[model samples]
Target: MPLHSLNHFKSVFIYDIFIQPADQNYLTARFLRVIGMHQDFFWHAQQTLEKLFKAGLVLNGVSVKSKSHELTKLLPIYEETLGSDAFNSFDKPKKLKAELWSDTSVKDFVTKISALGSADARYGLVGYQSSKDDLFKLDQLVFKLRQRTMGLDWVIGEDFRAEENLQHFNGKTYREFIEQNPTEQIRHLSIPYQELKSIGENTQDLFHAWNFEFQRKSSDIDKIAPGAIAPELAFSLSRIDALLQNIEAFDGFDKEFVPEGFKWLLDNVKVSSHWKKMIETYLSESKK
Candidate 1:
């Protein structure tokens, strides 16, 4: 049998080309927000949500303007194209307040970030205003879009195995049923909160180290290579006493920046064999 297929448009992610950039932006946005970099946060938040909306549009077979930044325009277009399947929001005026994830508030957010078509509102060039709430509501909208737009089909990789049984019915193959009814396989995508927290702390350290130069603090803005971050776990366990216990319990990988195994560093990582042996011997002394 061929691979199992879910033809529906559901909100899930595995290797979404759209999501990779969005993830980077998401990480950056949260970092900026934590560091009191509110202006840049607005811009990155707008970028993140805009990409998500575009992802929804593209996933649903809807055409998107490649160079549009107007969330007001993009959000509406994405909804209208998806139609009833779009999960569009309507306004509620007489309520006590617009709830956190309400349709009214989401649209309100899209409006606030919509000054993209005609001018660089991100820099306040067009005399428009934005607030921190823009990000809060945008986060809500991101969640909504994930559930409505992502389908389980995304998780199906090239190495995915097909089902043994093909249940054909209703004048349609199994793929047809799944494609039409995406909610059957609904899911959502997310990132680790702890990682975002670390990025913020590291960014602050880098900022202070370089005298708070927002621009050109390093060669690449996205790929920040800060020397140190807070809450160093390797040292957090009072290792002077627990050193031997921690060694045996080690994860067999360096957790400083991100997880990487000693084996890979031994083979593919660039370094002289002499240095590698020196470090290996140094670590071996811990066993004594």
Candidate 2:
């Protein structure tokens, strides 16, 4: 065979066979000769091949139809050149989409991909011609499953028994269940009960402030003298002004401070009033 064809053969074998258990020096000698390298090139080629394999590719049982008899000798050469860290650098897991609940193939792929060094290998497999949508779906499924698992106990909170029941129905359609048990929908989505409760408490606080301002303003206007402004009315107006100032100081409340404030409130604020009680109840029953 021509030198180029021989080089291609070596590349294929390295990626397809040699890395498994092939003879090293012979393969390196052949590879160096095919590339028109000096006698010293064999060691360099061997080292380079080893590095490539270590960077994460393996070909343990790869098929090579044209060279069945030579496989035994080639396999040892490939194995000697294989690197040790052949499966390290990989991506971490991320959240999944809601649609993968029913995909068995996706679930299987996730299981297999997860067995690989990192969740990131899925990204590489995802737009390839052979596994495109299936791989994507698997990635989505893994993310969703992990999210659900992480949020499980916290989301379910005191309702750990109910959470266990929900897990039993993991393969069931979430939409169908929600439709049948509309009341349960909130709980399913409300995992991390403490977080949900914190959100509810924050909302109540805003509502109470608004109501208090309304009532104070009404009382002030009612008690105002025909020709004189009541002191209570003046005080109420001042309080409203201060509250407005506070609100203004928090321009990006919804996005920035609100989430942190909710966490802080949940952790440090005591549940004392009726409003707090109501918020606690709402969170206790929200989805997980």
Per-residue lDDT of model 2, residues 1-288, tens digit only: 111222122222232222322224334434444444433332333332332322121222223222222222333433344323121122332454444333344224433323331223323432212222333442233223212111111222221222465664554543334435533422222121122322223433423333435553443334323222223354223221232234345332332332232233333323236634544543454323
Please, what is the whole-model Cα lDDT of each candidate in the order they appear? 0.49, 0.31
TM per candidate: 0.48, 0.17
**Candidate 2, residue 236: lDDT:** 23
lDDT winner: 1
| Clashes per model (N, Cα, C within 3 A) | 8, 21
Compose the digit string of candidate 1's lDDT tens values, residues 183-227: 452332455444343234566445544343555554334554344
Q: Which run of 10 residues does model 2 get worst, by summed lDDT?
A: 146-155
